[model samples]
Structures are given as structure tokens and as C-alpha cells.
Target: MSTPVDTPAPATTGAAPAALDVLHRVFGYDAFRGQQAAIIDQVVQGGDALVLMPTGGGKSLCYQVPALVRSGIGVVVSPLIALMQDQVDALAANGVRAEFLNSTQGPDERRRVEQAVLAGQVDMLYLAPERLKLESTRALLDRATVSLFAIDEAHCVAQWGHDFRPDYLELSVLHERWPTIPRIALTATATPQTHREISARLGLDDAAHFVADFDRPNIQYRIEPKAAALQQLLKFIRTEHAGDAGIVYCLSRNSVERTAAALADQGIAALPYHAGLDAGIRARNQSRFLREDGIVMVATIAFGMGIDKPDVRFVAHLDLPKSVEGYYQETGRAGRDGLPSTAWLAYGLNDVVQQRRMIDQSDGDAAHRRQLSAHLDAMLALCETIECRRVRLLAYFGQEFAPGGRESTACGNCDTCIAPPEAWDGTVPAQKLLSTIVRLEREHRQRYGAGHLVDILVGKRSPRVAELGHDALSTFGIGADLGEQEWRAVVRQLLAQGFVAVAGDGYGTLVLSPTSADVLGGRTSVRMRREPIRASRPARATRRAAAQPDMPTEAVPLFEALRVWRSTQAKERSVPAYVVFSDATLRGIAATRPDSIEQLAEVSGVGAAKLETYGELVLEVVAAAA
Candidate 1:
């Protein structure tokens, strides 16, 4: 006989509820992978946070769950209108009440969304920072029930960032205006300095900072010397990344067009995307790239911010990025779904020279120029370093990547580990270069840039050297034993080693740092990598052999089928296919061959709403494939 007892109902409110409920029931994940659960709890409890997560690190969930579980609306400030729309659509697809307000909408549309906000019908509201600065928009938000504020791409707030937004400077007003609302600022890539700047500028200085590891181990980092870059790119695509969705980033609009045309000539389905293109064309190309498979986007940096495409197998750089942050952010756009991806760059001495020249020629104040030079110098070190690229990159962000064993120290995924360059004792040439700069500074009371100084060292009778009387210096012509290339290498190493610095304004004059005295005084010896000779085609074949494709060949058909299904669903809903299900989700579905709705539910990213909406179709497809 069962005893009759009073049963208590489940308790709610006050104490933290199960975030895993939202994770599994809403987003279809079994659990929080890393710091996600902690981050979600912090925000839900009305605390502020500054999350420095890597790209595709499930950053959305940190705010999304709290937005749903907490009382009122989650206001998200994004820089791009398209990104706002895409994020909202994706949330809606996951059965979250998400809406966006942007310039693309008409008055009637805006009014409808505003009305929904007033009526408490929206869970998340995404707006551009510019829109948030409007008085009328402020009034509307003040009247509504606000839960929390999420600032996406928070690194844009840094004045020194490559993608600086003046509008982002005004975002701190959110905290002042809504003092009670918890705020979270998030970004994909930020160096230590950039991280500090973001927190201060966005008024998140008091927020709890959660920095995830910046290393993308699945990404194979390759830096090849530039010799006929177009041919090298073509060979890479044909041999290594055939039929894969990828981004080819160029430094200029003209290069974007030329690369796109060249890829097309080689029978690859390529599209050009740059600021110079007509707005309509750019939109259409971006849409096609998002919707279609086996399409390569040849673009500039303008094309990749807030791009949520997950199946990008590669991000190849035709030219150098301005900073490690830019390179990290740009390359991060690829393999976001945690699949193996390629980050390939073709760089040379010219790339270094050109990047320096651009910074010098820019019409900024001396301080601004110095800041830009500092950023570029870090990038150059990454390019020229023979150390593990992953180690160097993560170290820049203040994270140590000691992988336990000495064997683990070598990442085994970068060019350095595969084919390391011979390290030569650069002590002799380094001293020569440092002495030349010191001589110029002490004797002439003048500073010269790398180009002029290199001319002086290599015994070139250049006009600048002759006029400056640099040819008569003792250090002059002493380095003539090393050719111009070798001299440039030494100067680059000196700048990198902190033995020399770029000083003064307007095209930067070389100045000796305090550390230069050590090298000049024979207290320090610098060893630099002898740049490897350009590889022949057969040699490239050996490197290619070490690479592996992201997906298995057997899974190709099902992957295509899943893409088609996603595309169809996206079109029916008038949203992007990724809004329906990310490429990562579809790939998971294809690989697992989930034969039943129950099995499908067990897959990551298969939230309850998605299972209810597309379960039967997914099951049928899997069954037919079987």
C-alpha cells in the first residue's frame, strides 16, 4: 500500500534555474561545453560580463539563454544590419522570440517591431549601435522592459583596432542610461591591449572577464614565400582544397577582382566581393556564397565581419593583414564549426615593405602612426617567426600554450613543425644594422627609415644616403657582404627583437631602443631563420600529402542532401539557410546517420523546436540514404 503524502511542486525564480534546460530544450545541446554555463548564469543573475571567446565558440548562448530565462528583452548592439537580421532569424528558427530593428526596414515594419517590443512579444532585440544612439530609439527602449545588453564584436570599440567604429564609442551610454540592466561585451579576436581598451571603452571594466583559449588547433597554419602568388593559390585550390567553400582575401579591390577572374578562368565558381562593387552586386554575391556550395569568395577584409558561415574549409591570404588581430579575425571566419580548416598566407619581403609604407603614408598624427606601426610589427613577427605559429599567436593574447610534453610544444600543424627553416647566427648582421641606426641618430641627429638605412648598409649610392652623409658612416658598406635581401632580413629581425624601433612621425624613422645597447655591447646574440627558398611543384606535393580533407568522401552525398534540405527550408521561411540549421549541424546529422527523431534529438544543435519542425524530413532523408 502506498502512503499518502503531500508533494511539493518544482521551485522557480530567485535561485539559478537549470541553464541546461534551455541548452537542451531550446538549442538542442546536451550540455554546456566550456565556460558557457558559468557565463550564462552570471548574466541571468543580473551581473555584467566581458567574454573573450574564440570565433564559433558558442558565444551566442552566453546571452541568449539569459535573455529567455530572465524577465525582459535582451538588447543586442551589432555593427552590421545584415548580421542583426541573420542572428534574429536564427534565434527565431530555434523558437526564440527574436526581432531586429535596422535601416533596411520601412516605417511600418519598424513600428510593428516596436509595438511587439512594447507588448513584450520579443525576447531579443538586435540594433545597430548608431540606432541605439538615436533619441527616439532611446525613448522606446526606456519605455520597454529591458533585461540585459549584449555588445557583439566588442573589439570594434578600440580606437586602434583595424575595424574601428566611431559609433561604438557611444555604446557606453547604455550602462549609464540603464544602470540596472546587466551587460555583456563579446569579441572573437583581441590582443591584450585591445582587450583592455574594449573593456574600458564599453564601460565593462567592472564586468567579470571570461577569456577562452585563443588557439584554433584544427586550423593548419601555413605561410609560404610569395613567388607568383596566383599560381601558388591556384595549385593550392586544385590540389588541396578542390570543391571546398573558401575565402580568398586580397589586400585591395583590384586584387579581389583579378583573383576572382583568375579563379573563374581556372573553372572554379568564384565571386568578387569588395567595397568598390555595386551594393546590389555585393549583396547578391554574399547571399549566393551563403546559400550555395563549392563557391569561393575572393574578397577584401570588408566581406568577412559577422559572417556566420561555418563550412568555409579555408581562408587564404593573397596579401598580408595589418595586424595579428586582423589575421586572427579574418582566418577565424573559416572552420568556425570546429572542423579542420586551413589558414594559408603567401607573404614576402615586399609584403612587409608595403605594409610599413602604407602605415607611414597614412595621414594620421605621430601617435596614431606609432600605434599602427606597433600593430604591424607584431604581424611581421608572426610572419617571420620560425617558432610554432600557434604558440606565437596565442602568446600575443597573453595565453600560454604549453601542451605538457616537449613534443606537444611543437603544434605539428604549422609550416614550422613540418619543414623548419635553418637558423643562422644573425649576430654579425644584426650588430651592423643596429650600429648604422645609432650612428645616424648620434652623429647626424637624424633618423632614416628601413629603405634608406638598408641602402646605406648595402653600399647603395642612393640620393637619400648621399645627401644625409650616411655613406661615410663606419657601419656603411660593412654589411655589403650581405645582399639587399639579407640586409632587409636583418633589419626585420632587429625591429622584431626590440633591438631597434621605428621612431619619429610621417613614414617612420628607425631609432635604437634601449635594448639595442645590449646587442651593440656584445651582451646579446640574435639567431634568425634563413628564409626558405621557394618550393617547386613537386615539393608542394609533399606538403599537400600531409594535409587531410575536413569531411570524409563517403559523407559527401548526405552532406549535399542536408544542404539542399536546409536551403529549401531557408527559402520557405525567407531567411538564410544557416538560420534553419548551421552547416556544422547538417554535417553532424550526415555523419551520424540518425535514423529516428529520437536519435536525431541526441545530436548536438538539434534543439526541441528544430526536432518538431524538421524531424520527419530529416528521418526520411537519412532512411533513404541508408
Candidate 2:
């Protein structure tokens, strides 16, 4: 169990009877994982909690079991309105009374749910944080007998968090307005700073706080130096994750559309999803991605929050992520069912330049820009580091790790761990690059972006370089021993190391930082990674052989049959197939090959209501396969 670190634990509510009963009867889990029992017990006894568990660590159960065991409706504050319906339906499938109120509902629909709440028919009530600010909504809740309050994605209240929402700042009013209604704030991703901000902002200073292990041991983290990014992404998918559901994230709407189209052209079931698309199109795409298998949703980050798909095999980034928090949460979306998954990113020079330029041009004080710069710096270091990826990742969240149990690798499951990169002395390459920038500034009284600087270093007398007379400089051709790519790597690493600064117009011109003088004076040595060159097409066959598919040969037929049954049931009910039963659950059924409903109930994810609903149909499918 992950213990609560440096935070107060709520005194245990002695002798709780129905908590475990609700767990096994309602959700069909025999026992709680990690800190769920303690967190649930606290909430069930009218004590507050602040939970920071990773995605798919069963964060929902922390609030849910308590909601069912205690009296009155559990008021849940969910940030995403679009996902509320699916969430409510998933609970209903588990035989729990759940309802949601948001802008999408009609007046009659809202009234029906309100009447249900008034009559004490609702067990959990999902509301948007913005709804709490409404006077009429407050009065309605005031009249109803209220249980504990659940603030989902509670880290949004922290201004420095990756997904900041101003509306979450108002959530402290839940404790004030209903002072006795114990409020439990929950988020899957939170740094120490974000955690502190959440406690301060949500008035959870006295609440029991819990932090689960942030490391996802099942995910193999790999960062490639970007070269023909779309091609690299396609090859990765084809070789390792073909016919498997995944997400391909790009930074812009245009990139999302282009990547989706390109993948579709190659016979993949790809769909584009971003805020720039029409609302109806986005909804339809989201629905298909959820209902159908073997989909690759090419999207911006806008498409992933609140998504509960448990079988996502990989998450590929065509562009660099903004921060570690954003990257971790986005990657956490993959392999939610505890299967092996890959978190792959194609990172390069332009990503660094673009992020730095954005920070420079952003609207904020110097401190704010510094904050953004710090985040980008950390992200860049992660991409460039030669250490164990999981170790560095865990340390960022204040957890210590000792690397053990190798899996096709040296340390942990990551690119560097498998094929370790050499840390060569970058002093010469750094001096050559910094000399060009220094001479350009001293003699020409101007700095230049990487392209022009690289041309000068490589002795390439292009028209612009000739016109600018940079070819005559002493530093010109000083780096002729290395290729342009190698020179760019030196500059990229220097910028990442904070020895060189990105400054001037929005073009990402390079300048000397205060620390650059150390390299120029030979007072400090620069270290850089020598990444292995990527191979072309023929190597993919080898990768395909090494990569394991999602299912074994014997189970594939039964899994397909079960999927067909789930599809029919979902179509009849007009809900996503996963809402009926997640692919993880189906895979569990196929693997266990249960002959009776009692045996089916023994499988991990076959909850009480699910077993009661589909048990016979699943047994018939298994029998036919046999």
C-alpha cells in the first residue's frame, strides 16, 4: 500500500460494516488496492480527504464505495461536461443510482434528475464546478439531504498545474456552505507545489492526504530524436502496436488533421479530434474511438481528459509535450488495465525553439515566464538525460527508487536502459557553436537562429551567410569535423543544459547565458548524449517480432465473440461498448474461460451488476469457442 507522506491521516472510523460489503456486492472487487480502504473509510465517517492517485489506480473507488455505503447522494464535481453521461452510465451498469446535470440537458431532463435527488433516489450526483456558483443549484442542493462532496480533478484549482481551471478556485465554498458535509478532493496528477496549492485553495488543510506511487512500471518510456516525425510515428505503430487502439498527439489542430489523414491513407482506422473541428464531428469521432476497437485517434491534448478507455496500448507524441505533469497525465491514459504499454515521443530542435519562443512571447510577468521556462527545461532534460527514465520521473514527484528487476534492459524499462547512450565530452562542439554566436554578437552586433549559426559552423557559404560576410569570421568552419546534425545536437544540448540561452525576436535566436562564459573560458566541461542512428524499413520486421501483441492465439477467437456480444448490447442501449464492459473486462473473461456464472464472478473485473447482466451470454460464447 502507498502510504500518506508527510500529510495528516484522518483518525480511522472504527468498525465500518458495509464498506467491504458494498465493494464486493456493488463493484465486485474482493479487496481494496493501495490506500482506497483508508480513504473510503475516512469519507464514509464524515471526515475529509485529499487523494493523489495515478490514473487507473482506482481513484474512483475512493469516493464511490463510501458514496454507496453512506446516506444521501454523493455530490461529485467533475470538470468535463462531455464525459458526465458516460460516467453516470458506467455507475448505473454497476447497479448504482447515478445522475448528472449540465448545460447539455433539457429543462425536463434536469427536472427529472432534480426530482430524483429530492426523493432520495440518486446515489451519486455529478455536477460541473461552474454549477456550484449558481444560486438555484445551491438552493436545490440545500433542500436535499447531502452526503460527502467529491471534487474530482481537484488539482485544477492550483494555478501552476498543467490543467488549470479558474472555476475550481470556488470549490472551497463547498466546505463553507455545507460545513458539515465532508469534502474529499481528488486528482490523478499533482506535484508537491500543486498538492500544496490544492490543500490551501480547497481548504483541505486538515483533510487526510494520500499519494500513490507515481511510477507506471508497465510503461516503457522512449524518446527519439525527431526525424521525419510522421514517418517515425507510423513505423512505431505498424511495428509494435498494429491493429491496437492508441492515441497520436500533435500540438496543433492542423497537425492533428494531417496525421489523422495520413494514417487513414495507410489503411488505419484513424480519426481527427481537436477543438477546432465542428462540435458534432468531435463528438462523433470521440464516440467511434471509444466504441470501436483498433482505432488511432490523432488529436491534440484536448481529446484525452476524463477518457476512461482502459485498453489504449500506446500514446505517441508527434510533437514535444509542454511539461512533465502534462506528459505524465497524458501518458497515464495508456495501459490503464495494467498491460504493457509504450509512452513514445519524437522530440527535436524545433520543439525546443518553439517552446522557448512561446514562453518569451507569453503574457505574464518575468516570474511567470521563468516558471514556464523552468518547466520546459525540466522536460528537455528528461528527453536528453542518460539516466534511467523511471528513476528521474519518480524523483520529480519526490519518490526515491532503487532500480531492480531488469526487463530486456540495463536498469528500468526505457530506451536508455535497453541500449545505453554514450555520454561524450561536448566541450569542443559546445565551443565551436558558442564561438559562432559570440563572434556574431561581438562583431556583427547581432545573434542568429540555429539554421544560420549551423551554416556558419559547417563552412556552408550560402547566399545569406555570404551576404552577411559570416564566412570570413574566425569561427567559420571551426566545426567542419562534425556534420550539421551533430552541430545542431550540440546547440540543442547546450540550450537544454542552460549554458546557452534562447533570446531575441520570436525566431529563437541563440545568445550567451551567464553560464556560457564557463564553456568559452574552458572552466566547465559539457556532456552530451550520442544517440544511435535510426535504421530504415528492414529493421521493422525484427521489431514486429520482438513486440508482443495484445492477445494469445487461443484467446483471440473467444475475445472476438465476446466483443460482438458487447457491441450488440451497447448498440441496443446507445452507450459506448466500454461503458457496457471495458475491453479489459472482456480480456479477463476470455483469459479465465469461465464455464459458469459463479466462476465468471471470480474473474477480476466482473462486477456484481455486470455478472448479473451478461453472465449467461458470455458463458455461451465461451462454450461455443471451446
Candidate achieving the largest TM-score = 2
Q: lDDT by residue for model 2 over 431-508, one digit each (tens)?
A: 888888888999999989999999998999999999999999998888899998887788888888988888958778
Span of 10 residues, lowest total lDDT, candidate 2: 1-10
TM-score of 1: 0.83
- Clash pairs, candidate 2, are none
Highest lDDT scorer: 2
TM-score of each: 0.83, 0.94
Ten-residue region with minimum lDDT total, candidate 1: 1-10
495: Cα error in model 1, Å: 6.4
Model 2: residues >4 Å from true position, as ranges?
A: 1-17, 402-411, 533-553
lDDT of 1: 0.82
Q: Write the per-residue lDDT of candidate 1 for residues 251-292, one digit (tens) a residue.
A: 999999999999999999999999999988998898888877
